[model samples]
Each structure stands twice: as structure tokens, then as C-alpha cells.
Target chain A: MREAALSLFSRHGYAAVSMRQIAKEVGVQAGALYNYTPDKQTLLFELMRSHMDDLLSARAATGDSGQDAMARLEAFTRFHIHFHSQRPDEVFIAYMELRNLTPENFEVIEGLRRQYENGLEDILSAGQSDGVFAVSDTKIAAMAVIAMLTGVNTWFQEGGRLSLEEVEQIYWDMVRKSVAANP
Target chain B: MREAALSLFSRHGYAAVSMRQIAKEVGVQAGALYNYTPDKQTLLFELMRSHMDDLLSARAATGDSGQDAMARLEAFTRFHIHFHSQRPDEVFIAYMELRNLTPENFEVIEGLRRQYENGLEDILSAGQSDGVFAVSDTKIAAMAVIAMLTGVNTWFQEGGRLSLEEVEQIYWDMVRKSVAANP
Candidate 1:
């Protein structure tokens, strides 16, 4: 049911998609769908929450923070691109469906987002303290870097002019230079 | 009617907005709305096209291309942030509504988008040729830079931690360093 809702919500605006349609997609009775998620809003919130949780846990698992600042930054750059690219629908909903989430759900999602932002900010802060990254504001730099890396989804295709690895390397090069104190 | 449609479409998803609601917003009869746009799809297409035209004309007015590559790049970066920051609704719709456009409308919008991208790529290409920038792929770099700069809209709020001018300067500094040959 969650998958069905994510697919539908991503393709159609959340307002345009009916709960019945999600049930149809899932091949379940409409009443049965509520057993999983009480409502479409809950489903949307769960999808967004799960995406954030996955992102944070994936970052933690990388153990990149244990490395030097530059190494950690590279790990983050690559990891972000790799992670976001594989989940186009979830990424779209995560970004585009916030307005559809209820106010209370919105706050929870925003907190998760802030946690992710802080994770990246911490890396930038570490690098700044090391005198390797010369960003005037680490918070802004974290936002800028994540925006640049996540942008891979806006145009990237698997069999496009470049492979994912090539794309990753290109972005990392730009990101690495973008922050280095003396590139 | 067009203004009403833009506001409605930007607030609600395009698919979720109805001509009747737009008419109500404009305080006009539902039938009268058709005089402005034949249908919701056409309204959406026109809103998107007008946005592209406005962006192109605005950039042309800047005459950034006439400057040296580095100066042109700075001009582009600052202009993009300033322009996009001013039109949160348009920027949001332009990115979010592309999928909602008809196939033919999509083609026209894509062409215009490419033209805007090319304007930035030209600067990056000029910089590359001038040996001032070290970008392996100017096209990707152009996309990356534009994404990063336009992303200012995502988090930047007036009277926040930084003024718009400060934000522009910080982004410009990062952008300049990102592509500089010897940062």
C-alpha cells in the first residue's frame, strides 16, 4: 500500500490521487488499505519520513565521519548523489509533497530534514575548523552542496552521455573545489 | 484570470486546480475564464512560457555575456539568485509543473530551459577556453552551478541569518572557487 501510494502520489499530485486508486494499485480492498496507513496524509508522511531515515542511517553506516574532513566530505558528496538518484519517486514526493502533509506531520518531517542538514553541516564545520574549507557559513555551504548533488536527479539518466560514476566524480570535483580553502 | 490561475496552480497542484476555482478567485463567471485561457492546460503552458521568456529577457537585459568570463559568471550567479528569489511561485511552478505540461508544451519549455542553460554554459565555456576555469564538462558544471544558486529559494528567508546580498556574495564566492583554475 505504501509503495502504491508513493508511486501514485509521485506521478499525480497528492490531491489528485484518491485512496481508492492506491488500493487499486495495490490490489487490495479500499478498507484493507487503512490497516497499513490510516489516511493518505499518513502514507505521504511515512514515505517522506522513511526516505529521511534511510538517508541518515545510510550516512551513519558509511563511517565517513571517522575519516579526515576532506575524506568525509567526499563520502557525503558521493553518497548523496548515489542515494537520491536511486529513489526518484521518493525524492520527488519528499520535496513536492510537503505541502500535502498536515501541519503536525510537516513539523516532524522538517525535523528529520534538519537533522540531515546538520549532519552535512557538521562535516563542513569540521573542515572549516581544520582550515581546509573556507566557507563563510557552514550551514549555507551544506545547503548549497546538498542542492548541487541532489540536482543529479533533475537531468541524470542511466544511459545518458555519462555513467553514474562519471557524474559522481564530476560533482565531487566541483564540490571539493567549491569548499576547499586553497584549491 | 492568468494571475488567478498561477496563484491557484502554484498553491495547489495544477491537476488539482479547476477552472471554476480560478474563476472564483478572479471573481468571474466560470465561462468568462475561458476568454483568457481555453483550458487549464493552456493556462499552465502560458504561465510556464511567460516565465521562461521573462527569465531570458531579464538575463539579456543584464548583458552579462558582454563582460569577461569571470565577470559574466559572477553576474549570472548573482542574477539567478536575485531573480529566482523574487519569484518563489514562478520558480516553484517552473520546476514542479514541467511534468504537468503536455508533450508539445514540454518540448517548448525544454527548449527555453536549454537556452537559459546555454547562456550559463557559454560563460563556463568561455572561462574554460580562457584558462580561467578548470571544468572537465562545462555543461554539467553549468547545470550544477545553476541548481546550486537557484536553490537559495529553498531555505533563504528575509531577515534571516543573512541578507540577500550576503547570501549572493557567499554563493558567488563558492561558485567562483568551484570553477577557478587555481583557487
Candidate 2:
């Protein structure tokens, strides 16, 4: 049911999708949806929050321990690629429909986003301190890397010539070289 | 008039912005908007298409001729960043409201997008042939570079910590190193 709502919200913008359409997609009366979500705004907030939580928890469980900064960054890159590909609709909704979130909800999601971004920044800072990375601006570099990785969701299609793993390797290689200490 | 529409569309989305609201924003009767556009779909299409056309023409006039591949790439990057920053609403509408375009109109914009992507690919290919660039996948690299440039539309603000020129320089540095022939 949430999947149906996500697809509808992602395909059409969140404001254009209604509880009636979501109910129709789920083959239930619109009134029944109220049992799950109080209103359209609530639904949007829940979907976005859930998706961010999933991303954060997944990254935490991936365990960056014992890996060099480069290795950890590569792992994070691959994980982001894999997770987004698996749930493209949710990822798209999370990104494109963010403005639909209420101010309170927006801040919650934004905080989670900052935390996720800070994880990458932490790695970059660690790499710089350890003489493994050379970047003029860690903040900008982190943003750039996240932008490059999240972009996979915009263009990636399953069953294309390159598998998700192959795409991850290619991106990881580009990212590593882009900020490498020697490069 | 168009500025009001663009801001509303950017915030509420193209589909949700009614002709009545647009007319109100423009301080005209609802029926008066029909004198300008046949329908909401046409308004959205024109907003996106004209912006893309402007981008293409601006890039073409930037006079990247006689420059090496790296120099040309840098010039293109700077132009893209500057143009996108100046007209973020148009850029946002072009990306987010694309699905609202009729099939025929969508094809026209898609063709323009392909041309833009091909420009990057062409530069990468030239650099590779001349032994000045190394990339594992020209197609993916082209998409990645465009994505990175287009991302400015999402987060960039006029009075943000980084100036437009500074942001472009940082991105250019990353992009050049990402596809540089040698580390």
C-alpha cells in the first residue's frame, strides 16, 4: 500500500497525488487509509522519514570499522548505490518530494540527512588527517561525492549492460581518484 | 507573471499549481491566462523548453573553440554553473516537471538533453583519443559529470557561504581530476 503511494507520489509530485488516488491504488476505500495515515501530509512525512531511517540504519550496520578512509568511502558508495537501486521509488520520493514535508518534518529529515552527510565528511576529515586524502574543502568534497552517488537513482535502470556492482566499482574508482592524496 | 508561476511550481509542483492560482499571482482573471497558454500542460512545457533552449544557446555562444579538451570542459562547467544559479527556478522546473510534458514535447526536450550530454561525451572522447583523459566508461562518466553540474540547482543560493565562481572552481577541480588522463 505504501509502495503504491510512493510510486504515485514519485511519478506525480506529492501535491498532485491524493488520498483517494492512493486508496484507489491500494484497492481500498479512501476512508480506510485514515486508519494508517491521518492525512496526505502525514503520509508524505512518514514515507520520507522511514526512507531516511532505513538509509541511516543500513549505513550504520555496514560497519566502517577497520577500513581505511578510502575503503570505507568505497563501501559507503557501493551501499548507497545498491540500496537506492533496490528502492528507486522510495529514494525518488525522498529526494524530489522533500519540499512537501512540513517544517517540523522537514527539519527532522534534514537533520538525518546532515548526519548521513557528516558520516562521509568524517571519513574525509580522517583521511586528510592521516595523509590519505588531499581535498581543498572537505565540506564541498563530501557534498560532491554524495551528489555523484545519489545521482545513480536518477539514471540507473535495472538489467542494463552494467550491473549495480559494476556501476558501484566505476563510481568508486572515479571518487577515489578524484580526492586521492597522490592524484 | 512567469516568475510567480515558476516559484509556485518549484514549491508546490507543476501539477498542483492551478491556472486560477497562477492568474491570481499575475493579478489577472483566470480566463486571461488562456490568452497566453492553451492549457496548464503547455505552460509547463514552454517553461521547461525555453529554459533548455536558453542553456544550449548560451553554451554555444561561450566560444569554447580552439581550447584544449580540459579547457573546454572547464569553460562548459563554469557556464553551466553560472546559468543554473541565475535561473534556479527554471532549472528546477525543467528537471522536476518534465513528466508533465506531452510525449511530443517531452521528446523535444529529451533530444536537447541528449545533445548536452553528448557534448560532454564528445569532450571526453576527444581527450581520450588525444591521450589527455582516462575514463572507464565514457557514457557513465558523461552522465555523472552532467549530474554533478545540474546538482547546483538543488542547493545553491545567491548569498550562501560560497560564491558562484568559487563553487564552480571547486566543482571544476573535482570534475577535471575525475576524468584527467593522469593522476
Candidate 3:
């Protein structure tokens, strides 16, 4: 049901989709959806919150424990690109449906997003302290790096002119230099 | 009518907003709207295409004529941040409503966007040739820089913690170092 809702919400706006449509897409009664999510808002919030949770959990799993700041930053870049690329629908909803989220729900999702961004900022801060990265502001730098990396989803296709590995390499090189004290 | 439509389209996804709602928002009857635009899709396409045209024109006005590549790049970074920050709704629709454009409209808008991006790429390519930048792929670098800069609209508030000037300086610093042959 959540999968059906996600597809509908992403293709059609969340507000445009409803219980009946989602239920129809799921091949179930509209009442059955209430058994699962209770309401459309819940469904939207769950999808966004879960995406953030999954992102953080996955980041934890990809931890470069005891690594240098540079290495950890590279790990983050790779992990972010790979994770977001695989889940186009979730990524689309996560960004596009923010306005539709209730305030409390938006906070939860935003908090999780901040935590994820802070992970990268922490790396930048550590690198700055270690005199490896000459970032002016670690917070802003983290956001800049993130937006740059997440942009892969906009144009990346499986069999494009460049392979994912090639694209990754290109972005990684730019990411490394973007914050490097001496490239 | 375009303003009313743009606000509606950006707030509600283009697919969700109807011609009746737009006409009401513009203080006109539904039948009267056809005199201005043939249909909702045309309104969306015009809003999007005009945005691109305006962006390109603004960019041209901010062009770094007879300047070095580094300065030109800096001008672009600052100009892009300032221009996009002011038109939050248009920027939002420009990114979010692409999925709703007709295929032909999509291509026209996409082509205009490419032209805008190519402007930045041209700067990067020139910088590379001039030995000021070491960008491996100028195309990807332009996109990365753009995505990073445009992200300001996602979180920027009028009286936020950082002034626009300050934010511009921070991003410009990162952009310069990101592409610099030697940071």
C-alpha cells in the first residue's frame, strides 16, 4: 500500500492523490488502507521519515570507522550518491512533498535530514581542525557538497554517455578539491 | 494570470491545479482565461519557459565582459545566488514542474536550461584552458556548481542568520577552491 502511495504521490502530487486512488492502485478497499496508515498525511509522513531513517541507518552502516577526515568525507560522498541514485522515487518525494507535510512531521523529517547533513559537517569540521580542509564554514560547506553530490540523480542514467563509476570518480575528484586545503 | 498560475502551480503541483482555480485566483471567469492562454498546460509551459528566458537575460546582464575567467566565474556564482533567491516561487516551479510539462514543452524548457548551464560550462572550459581551473569535466562542474548555489532557495530566509552577501562569499570561496588548479 505504501509502495502504491509512493508511486502515486511521486507521479501525481500528494494532494492530488487520495484514499480511493491509492486503494485502487493497491488493489484493495479504501478502508483497508486505513488499517495500515489511517490517512494520506500519515502515509506521506511515513514515507519521508522512513527515507531519512533509512538514510541515517545506511550512513551508519557505511561508517569509515577510525578513518581520517578526508577518507570519511570521500566515503560520505560515495555513499550519498549510491544511496540516492537507487531510490529515485523516494528522493523525489523527500524533496518535492515537504510543503505538504504537517508541521510536526516536517520537523521530524527535517531533524533527520539535519542529522545526516551534520554527519558531513562533522567531517568537514574535523578536517578543518586537522588543517586538511580550508572550509570557510563547515555547515555551509556540508550543504554545498551535499547539493552537488545529490545532483547526480538529475542527469544520471544507467547507460548514459558516462558510467556511474566514471560519474562518481568525476564528482569525487571535484568534492576532494572543493574542500581540500591544497588540491 | 501568469502570476496567479505560477503561485498555484508552485504551491499545488501543476497536475493538481485546475483552470477554474487559476481563473478564480486571477479574478476572472473560466471562459475568460482562454483569451489569455489556450489552456493550463500552456500557462505552465509559458511560466517555465519565460523563467528560463528571464534567467538567461539576467545572466547576460551580469556577464563578466573583458574579465578574467576567475572573476567571471565569481560573478556567475554571485549572480545566480542573488537572482534565484529573489524568485522563490519561480525557482520552485522551474525544478518541480518539469515532470508536468508536455513533451514538446519539456524539450523547449530543457533546451533553454541547457543553454543557461552551457553559459557556466563555457566559463569553466575557458578557465581550464586559461590554467585557472583544473576541472576534469567542465560540464559536470557547471551542474554541480549550479545545484550547490541554487540550494540557497531551499533554506534561505529574508533575515536569516547569514546575509545574502555573506552567503555568496562563502559559496564563492568554495566554488573557487573547488575548481582552482591549486587551492
Which candidate number has the best DockQ?
A: 1
Q: Model 3 segments beyond 4 Å from truth?
A: none
True contacts kept of 3: 0.80
Error of 2 at B41 (Å): 1.3
Better of 2 and 3 by TM-score: 3
Per-residue alpha-carbon lDDT of model 2 for B58-152, expressed as tens digits?
Answer: 98899787889988889888987888888877877787777788899999999998898888898888888888889999989988887877787
lDDT tens per residue, model 2, A70-142: 8888888888788888987787777778878888989999999899989999999989998989888888888
CAPRI quality band, candidate 1 = high
Writing each residue's lDDT as its tens digit, candidate 3 over B13-84 gives 888889999999999999999999998889999999899999999999875878989999999999999999
List runs of model 2 lying over 4 Å from the truth.
Answer: none
Q: Output the better candidate (2/3) by DockQ.
A: 3
- Residues A1-183 of candidate 1 have per-residue lDDT tens digits of 778888888787898899999999999898998888888888888889999999889888988746989999999999999999999999888888888888999999999999989988999999899999899989999999989988889999999999999999999999999999988
How many clashing residue pairs, candidate 1?
A: 0
Rank candidates by lDDT, best first.
1, 3, 2
Clashing pairs in 1: none
lDDT of 3 at B70: 94
* Higher-DockQ candidate of 1 and 2: 1
Candidate 1 residue runs with Cα over 4 Å from true position: none
lDDT by residue for model 1 over B1-183, one digit each (tens)? Answer: 778888888777998888899999999899998887788899999999999999999999998646789999999999999999999989989998899989999999999999999999999999999999999899999999999998899899999989999999999999999999987
- TM-scores of all models? 0.98, 0.95, 0.98
